[model samples]
Target: MTLAHFLHGLRCASCGTLNALWLDLIRALVECHQCGQTALTLTDTDEGRSL
Candidate 1:
């Protein structure tokens, strides 16, 4: 999967730490690298993430 967009220096909602957004497969997700927590998950495809 390739990154469609990235929010550099963004804050995580779950961990309250700086994070980056990346595209995994068809899903756009944000994880706190410091805390290893998934802060958010969004559908990157027209029908959402799929196998």
Candidate 2:
């Protein structure tokens, strides 16, 4: 999936560390790279606003 956005300063729920996350717009998911946490799952409406 192509990355649509890069979200910075996101706190990971699993690791409790602030990290920059890659937003996969096609999948509507935002995941933490540091701890492999699925930080957010966005809906269609939310996806549009994110960009």
Candidate 3:
């Protein structure tokens, strides 16, 4: 859902990379391919954060 919503994907704040692929087979957090930083999740106004 996250990946589908943000079709172009989010840019990594640390390394500045665009990650648009499947986050993981079991997880939902997308990792930075360039910096290898696993720092991303889907958060709503009331739900806080999701992984």
Candidate 4:
């Protein structure tokens, strides 16, 4: 997805920068652009919780 489609409100664990999350659906990874940190890994249980 484009940068405009990045998920906001997420803070980078390494850099403490906010609004820097990029969700990669294929890999089920949520990463921070500012610090290159893998903040979250989407699991089957997480999918249910979001809804």
Candidate 5:
């Protein structure tokens, strides 16, 4: 299983629509793009601010 993060949220930069994808792997994350939506690209942060 993949590591789960609370930061599991995708914000459509185009239409500003927030969608949950982590919980749903069957659906394409960019499907909303056809309707003028952008997928929120996630950037993981260090567990303790790695130096």
Candidate 6:
């Protein structure tokens, strides 16, 4: 089977740490390098809004 993936962005809910995200493994939990916190939430803020 063929696989597809997309890369987005991720932010820490507590410290506001932003990073790249891959849609292929989004279901898998990721951790933040700065605050040592796991990825709890993801949002699209390119349109000018607070996530």
- The Cα local distance difference test for each model comes to 0.56, 0.71, 0.57, 0.72, 0.42, 0.52
User: Per-prediction TM-score, please?
Assistant: 0.40, 0.59, 0.43, 0.60, 0.28, 0.37
- lDDT for 47 (candidate 2): 55
For candidate 3, give the lDDT.
0.57
Which stretches in model 6 have alpha-carbon errors above 4 Å? 1-8, 20-27, 39-51
Instruction: Mark the 10 consecutive residues where model 3 has the least summed lDDT.
Output: 1-10
Candidate 3 vs. true structure, TM-score: 0.43
User: Clashes in each model (backbone N, CA, C under 3 Å)?
Assistant: 0, 0, 0, 0, 0, 0
Q: Give the lDDT ranking, best first.
A: 4, 2, 3, 1, 6, 5
Q: Whose lDDT is higher: candidate 1's or candidate 3's?
A: 3
Q: Which structure is stronger by lDDT: 2 or 4? A: 4
For model 3, the stretches where C-alpha displacement exceeds 4 angstroms are 1-9, 19-22, 40-51
Candidate of highest TM-score: 4
Give the per-residue lDDT digits (tens) of candidate 1, residues 1-51: 355555586776666665444334445455456666654465466676567
RMSD of 2: 5.8
Of 1 and 6, the candidate ahead on TM-score is 1
Q: What digit string (tens of lDDT, one per residue) describes model 5 on residues 1-51?
A: 444332236664555556633322333234343244424444367655867
Instruction: Compose the digit string of candidate 4's lDDT tens values, residues 1-51.
Output: 433248877677788888987887766677888778884464585656763
Model 3, 1-51: lDDT tens digits are 233333266777777667643364246566656776774666577676666
Q: How many backbone clashes are present in model 6?
A: 0
Whole-structure CA lDDT of model 1: 0.56
Q: Write the per-residue lDDT of candidate 2 for residues 1-51, one digit (tens) a residue.
A: 476677776676677777646688877788777777774574585756753
Q: Rank the candidates by TM-score, best first.
A: 4, 2, 3, 1, 6, 5
**Least well predicted 10-residue stretch by lDDT in candidate 2:** 42-51
C-alpha lDDT of residue 13 in model 5: 50
